[model samples]
Target: MNYLCLAGPTASGKTAASLAIAQALAERGRPVEIVSVDSALVYRGMDIGTAKPGAAERAAVPHHLIDIIEPSEAYSAARFVGDAERLIAEIGARGALPLLVGGTMLYFKALFEGLDAMPAADRAVRAALEAQCERDGLHALYRELQRVDPVTAKRLQPGDQQRIQRALEVYRVSGQPISSFHTEKPARELPPLISLEPADRAWLHQRIEARFHQMLEDGLVDEVRRLEARGDLDADMPSMRCVGYRQTWEALVEDDLSELPERGIAATRQLAKRQITWLRGMPQRQVIACDAPDALARAVECALRLVA
Candidate 1:
């Protein structure tokens, strides 16, 4: 199916650009709907930390793939591919442009092209990794993952024992970084992709820090606490493992809320780094400097051309 994609790091103006592009399309008497590519935005109670579109924004433009699931459940690229394909066709059938937007590059890759067939889980290796984790702690395993698979390491939170152990298991089983498997997928027709990236890393880092702090001010810790009160979620869940949620959860557990700001900001910056890495890998995408004064206009122009 033909569609348009706008991707970038967290806090890179992707959401703002999507809203602008949709509004621009509306002004031209063309209908448009945003299909979120973010993995985190799927959860119901994850509004503040995910920076999900507010009621007014969702009222302005139709949004899909958001608030479709609960925090206790996991969302995968395979599931995203199926859901997105259906959404794209439905939106097009309704005479609206299917505009995909978010920093979840894996979902974008899976939707436009295809996902890599990752290796099967080695139970013995996983058990050993679990034993190691139990004995030495998640930090030890996370460090080993950093040594063997830095790309995957950058993508996972240090407290994310589930993915950290899984990365190590894959490395031990295949003797290669999990990142390599993603590159092995055959190239195919991708949607016209517009990437919102900052020209200066520092600019993006500053925004990451500022936005995370803003989440706290908007009740990020309380948000995590409410989720924790659910008693069904933990740091191991993919939802809790999100940048801000995991860091805040840990801080609350450790009885040190003061550390939440630093931890959350640092984790978010790391997430941005991995996102930039993913965007650079897509050589065919159009790049707009998200830190530029005209970034929104530039992104809107490119998106309009794609859908025109």
Candidate 2:
């Protein structure tokens, strides 16, 4: 199968670049479809925060793996691998090249190297630990994690609530460290994948800030309002905990846009830094350094070379 994956840090102009490549392939009479590699974009009514493609852009080329689930359901990288592989195969069956695009590194990892079984959520233990978190504070629970799953705890930021809760839940159910379950063997597969990185960090940061401001101008607040109105802000909803969505929710509750947008921008910048680190680690894929205007051309050149 001829599959092309476009991955980079959040706010790295990856969306536009990937779309451009897909359009270029289409222009060359190659049947192509975009399958989102994003975790957040899978949830419905999460358009602005996830930066999901608008109706016009999607109509221009078929997009898949988006808006496939409600916010209340949690999805894992293993599930994403299953769904994405199925979609890619169906697209390939129809003689179309599948262009995989997004920033979820775990999804890419799972797709490439497969995941071992992890403990499922133990609601009883989760409820007890979550209650403990509410009463004793998240730090107390995180400290508890540090005692048992020290390695995983070290990897997580102290303030990371989701992962902390998950680790605690794992200990409760499996009677073992969550870190033990994370197993990957050194295996290799040749995928028709092309990745792009911007040469200048300063330039990419500016683009990140500009794109976030544009999202606000495009009614991100209203989008959040609509999702909130639909009860998507409820704690059980997975989309509520997305990075951007969480910040916006804080803004909504505080009614403070004065500093929230800048906070959002800063968070996005940090995320982009992590993405750059991820890209640097993936040594096998074809890499192209990009500027805005020439990014598409460079990526297309790489893709054609790979598929040749």
Q: Which candidate number has the best TM-score?
A: 2
Q: Which ten residues in a row have the lowest lDDT in candidate 1?
A: 182-191
Tens-digit lDDT string for candidate 2 (1-308): 45878888887667777777777777788878999998899998788878888898899889998999988778888899899989888999998899998888878878878887998876578678768988999999889999999999999988777779989888889999999998867886747656667778888888788888888898888887777788635634557767677777778888887886788888888778766777676767777676556777888777766655
Q: lDDT tens string, model 1, 60-144?
A: 8999999999998878888899999999999999988899999998887677678777777675787788678889999999899
lDDT of each: 0.87, 0.81
Model 1, position 140: C-alpha lDDT score: 93
* Candidate 1 CA-lDDT value: 0.87
lDDT of model 1, residue 77: 89
For each candidate, C-alpha RMSD in Å?
4.1, 2.6
Q: List runs of model 2 lying over 4 Å from the truth.
A: 122-142, 154-162, 184-186
Best-fitting candidate, measured by lDDT?
1
